[model samples]
Target: MRELYVKSLPLQDVIANLAEAFETTYFISCHEYRINVPEGYGSGFIRGINFSSGFGLIEYSCTFKESIKIHFSVNKIHPLKFIYCSEGIIKHRFEEKDSLHLIDQFQNVVVASTAQNGHILLFPSGQKIHMNSLEIARKDFKTKIDCDLHYVDKNLRKLFRDLNARNLFYYHGNYSLAMSECIDEIKNNTLLGFTRRLFLEGKANEILSLQINDFEDDQKAEPKRQILRKVEMTQIQKAAQILKSELANPLTIKDLATRVGTNPTKLQEGFRFTFGATVNNYLNKLRLEYARDQLMIGDLNISEIATNIGINNKSYFSRLFKSTYHLNPKDFSKQISKNVLLEKL
Candidate 1:
């Protein structure tokens, strides 16, 4: 096992420390510092970016060759941290504590240690870890012009107001689909320079909002009323995979739900939340997408394409395809053929 210590404040210093520790090069553009892991240590990169608003984002996407522990210790009060694990597992514990909290995929934790207690993160060997940390310097954040946090939940409001770090705070819950989508956008964004900075700042706040909401929703006593849990999401994704694989002979909603270990009502709710469509509608959309691919290939006629995608009614399939892509299937296929011929000529 290897240990790395980072004693720094703000993102830039942290990244510099990490680059030194990893013996790798880091690039900086518009205040964002990014470093790729060196050959001997691991694969992937670590990034840290901060905004004038006192909010910072650090992304750790890596697979270490050996177990590694990164300790974050600052001389002053540590910044509030909201940590989310999107892949693999990460173990976290306050500097002064002994027990470990495992943040599994789709799980998030909000932590604020007392005074300058600091934090420790453990990354297991050979596991792909993708985690994000949203840090806030409470004193700096409070001084911002738009720092009003009255709308926040009562407990969180208190946590936000605690600039002196008088109390230790920690909350754990499964993040929402909304939060997951925001993470995806943050990870996959292609914007550059100043525009990228603006985008990241906005996304940081958006993710903070989602994290707060997800935590509050998890506090509800009624499990049924609470937002979806990570386990529930697993079931939902399993159902979606089944839907895609068994399109030609898809199971009924109840049967599918049973197969995926969830109830039908919950399954429907999951579909609406994750895919923004009813199961039937989502299935039809998949069929249409598959039909479009077949149409482009040109080997299958409209009727065969429709049948292959599980829609036996050629007329209904044609109408659905047209409604989705703005052209009839037959006409779309002809257009593809015409384009190909023109290219050949």
Candidate 2:
């Protein structure tokens, strides 16, 4: 993955000279906090690319003052922008249509243009706006309708609202704090690189699914059919409990399925649907938890600990331990011991 930062103002001159630049519009400025982008140009209006991978491109803009108008005209590229307002408000006029008024500390808007004619407006200062542009190729987009709709679908919007409501308890309704934590982790934590991105994408999809469910519920539509059978559910529960009890053992999905009297496919699907994680994922989590307890309480060498946890592959076990804890096993053990000594002091 590569990241690019571009902020050259006197953007008025850039806008005048660069006819090929793309212009996108956003009504809500608060959505900027949700984007992952590089920081540039302290106070003035700034534009830069945050991250670009095989997944897509994310561009950002942080503006302090509002000019009369700002224009970005690009080639034939369709990208989605998530805008966040840090301070004031912005009225957005799109395709010269009636202006859409949005105000608040934060908001998220997704925009895509097919042919031409796309524009946006920014209001007075005291507020800032951030933008993330995700580029989806037309060919790949057709193959992944579910992935595409995950961002702009109405159902996903409701899901975000619901999750935001829950997050209010965490951040006292300050969306910026919640968003900053996500972005900070994205920037600082190497372990979170791919998984964090995947998680964000999954959250977007879940939001979309929730919106669809809500719409169906509102119209009195029948619920989506579930694929899990009673037998499957029972087997999944059994396998999970067994895995929980035996975290030290080498566990395979096939072996778990056999023990639970089900096939591997059913076992995998049932565990995921019922527990929100695959069997191996759940098992690894369980092992990590047990390993933590052992590290804190037991006097054991790393190899001995790994053996006791049923991880006979010591090197693989060490890697998993470090990935889970962000510290090598010996270091983690030493840190725990240090904490214990401090408490005694």
Candidate 3:
């Protein structure tokens, strides 16, 4: 019932040390690199790419029977770190900081630290850990040959400047579905050989691009409403899951709001803030995307596909599909067919 701080290391050394400290084996190939700690005594897996271009990724999931504290150092070369935790609690504090800051599940933090090399990470025992780290080497990024970070946030661009300002900065917020999905695709990618290396590099850049672009979009789109309480945000997100799952019968925003015990205005505002889209827009995009997938793979005609996605009127469905993709359902299916035939040829 008491708290504890467990272990710490240089930020870059975490993966190597984890492999050495635990009985895990660190395996590498042209495709990917991973360390697997077999079941019993904090079982987990850390798998990602260590690209030569100075950018790196680490995807980790573990469950420890005891609390853990990971103290780490960051040098000036790669002073900024963007970290996302898909699940579990992540507590971090800099050396000069008076207190710890929490990065909750599905949230991320962009860290810009002073040249000082002292930071600590804390995770409670008995809680599962799921995390993804996208480490950017500022030195590498500052050069055009190594990488281009033009679209990254201004705070990140500061790392490239030759200045004496090395103050600590941490930008924390929720990770969008686009970013979460991109990470999943990176982890699940099955290509091999040189193609895998290219894929890794591409996906790594994509991770940065998605985070940067999505955060900027949110800043512009988010409404200036009073902050919702923790319970309200949780309720709003839960309401979103309901909308996603119950697509067969759409619910009015007012009805959805009522179901989650909130008024329509707060529900709509909270939904946009939490998910980065209005309730109606999110649902519309979700339905259309699902229908597009079905068109490519399912053995159904355009009308059937329309009916399958809960649209009783086929013409209305076609219009919606065309508006979203610039092609009606049937034409979209035919284009996919044409591409498949070309591949076979």
Candidate 4:
């Protein structure tokens, strides 16, 4: 198994060279540019085949300005590809015949061989692939397996999706500095070499364990269902919306209950029942979200934004922000600047 690193080559040239080197009937190109590969590859024409270290290979590419096209043959073995868009939008067409998958900034598209006709092509701003077979083989020979891969397979995809979605939503929607740090760690540090493979194998089993525990608890739990009437549900939703929209204003449970035509106690209970948290907790979340947006966009001072979000005490606001996000306002602000610098690099 070899690690191939190619940079600054024109997309067409890379594809032509790769096809010939691999001696395959066709080569699939997954990139952000339009590339044409000539037939009957010869000298300097790309062709070669190398055993991949893992079941698949991970490749990273970036494009500035022009869009690129990738070509892949129908019969080639396809490895699952995880495309992460850091900056620009990428449009991908699986085969010559399918509708293109449009991936926007900060979003990811996962392509599996199971879905494609034995081949997958991607057009991405940047991506990382985890070749499963190569990785499994390498690990299988070197170490004794302790976990069940089959169990992990059942839940890994869903867990990854959930983790990705949560990170994406927080990243895009704006959250406090603490949340941002967690997101960064999850993005950059969560999956590496051995750890990533272990996660890929054990995540599903871990999730299953949790689910079983939850089910056991549920079985032992008293079954008192709080059945909300339609009107009650509508009022709870309205209250949540109001809280979200008016985070800067002073709000009380009584005020929220009055707005929803319910008593404060019932309103509190209904909100907890519907959202799984107290109304005050929900409001704090909204406030933190608002603060996060201000921090990410760099438009307002932390104190001013905090004040506007009804946090009159500056010290208290900072503490709350730190508690919620793991980073205080200033550090979070600085971290955002750092991310911008990394992006530019």
lDDT of 4 by residue, 72-108 (tens): 4434223334443433455555443466666554444
Model 2 lDDT per residue over 1-345, tens place: 111122222222222232222232222121221222112222433322222222342333455332334443433332333343433455544433555645344433334333433445444443455433233333333445544555554543432333112211100111222343343333343434456556555433443343243333333322222233332456688888999877667568878877877677667768777778988788888888878888888677788878767888878888999998999888999999899899999
Candidate 2 stretches with Cα past 4 Å from truth are 1-226
| Candidate 2 structure lDDT | 0.48
Scored by CA lDDT, what does every candidate get? Answer: 0.87, 0.48, 0.69, 0.47
Q: Estimate the overall C-alpha local distance difference test score of candidate 1.
A: 0.87
Q: Write the per-residue lDDT of candidate 1 for residues 135-169, one digit (tens) a residue.
A: 89988888762356777788888998898999999
**TM-scores vs. true structure, each candidate:** 0.74, 0.34, 0.60, 0.35
Write the residue-wise lDDT of candidate 3 on 1-345 in tens digits: 223221323333555666665656677677466777555556777776666645777777877767666655434333356788877887888755768889888788877656644566676777888888876555554564325555566655665452333666677777765677676777578888789879878877887877776556545533432334333577787788887788778788878977887667668768676767889888888789889888889587777766656789888888988999999888898899999999999
The segments of candidate 1 whose C-alpha lies over 4 angstroms from its true place after superposition are: 144-148, 224-226, 229-231, 237-266, 273-276, 279-345
Model 4 misplaced stretches (Cα beyond 4 Å):
1-230
Which residue pairs collide in model 3, if any? Answer: 6-69, 8-71, 9-71
| Model 3: residues with Cα > 4 Å off, grouped in runs | 1-14, 38-40, 74-79, 145-153, 160-165, 218-221, 224-345
lDDT of 1 at 178: 79
Span of ten consecutive residues with least summed lDDT in model 3: 1-10
